[model samples]
Target: MSFNPKDALDAVRDIATNAVEKASDIVENAADIIRGDIKGGTSAIVANSIDIATHAVDRTKEVFTGEDDDED
Candidate 1:
């Protein structure tokens, strides 16, 4: 059998194209998962910060109004 250069090149090209496409899909999926995780983490941080701020404000108010003096 004679080797056809054009057919060999076409086969290589097809294989390379498929590999690149699969790699791109994997990268896209990974990026999506990372984005979701970051969003969830940010939301949790915001909620915790708000809770901490509220507690701080309540404590400050108590201190300023002499309510904390009773404990001392």
Candidate 2:
């Protein structure tokens, strides 16, 4: 059997193209996962910040009012 250089080069190109396509898909999936994690972390931080602010405001009102009422 005789080997043709042109055919061999074409086969090599096809293999390289497939590998690059698969690698691109993997990178895209990883990026999507990272984005989701970041969004979740940011949401949690915002929620916690709001809770802290609310608590601070309640405490400040209590300190300024000087009333011994069980409301708040």
Indicate which candidate wins on TM-score. Answer: 2
- Per-residue lDDT tens digits of candidate 2, residues 1-72? 355566556545654565565556555555655778666555555554565555545444444554324554
- Per-residue C-alpha lDDT of model 1 across residues 1-72, encoded as one tens digit per residue: 455566556545655565565556555555655778666555555554565555555454454453543477
On the 0 to 100 scale, the lDDT of residue 49 in model 2 is 53
Error of 1 at 15 (Å): 0.8
Q: Which ten residues in a row have the lowest lDDT in candidate 1?
A: 61-70
Candidate 2: lDDT of 54? 55
The TM-scores of all predictions, comma-separated, are: 0.40, 0.41
Worst lDDT run of 10 residues, candidate 2, spans 59-68
Model 2 CA lDDT for position 23: 53
Model 1, residue 32: what's the lDDT? 55
Colliding residue pairs in candidate 1: none
TM-score (C-alpha) between model 2 and the true structure: 0.41
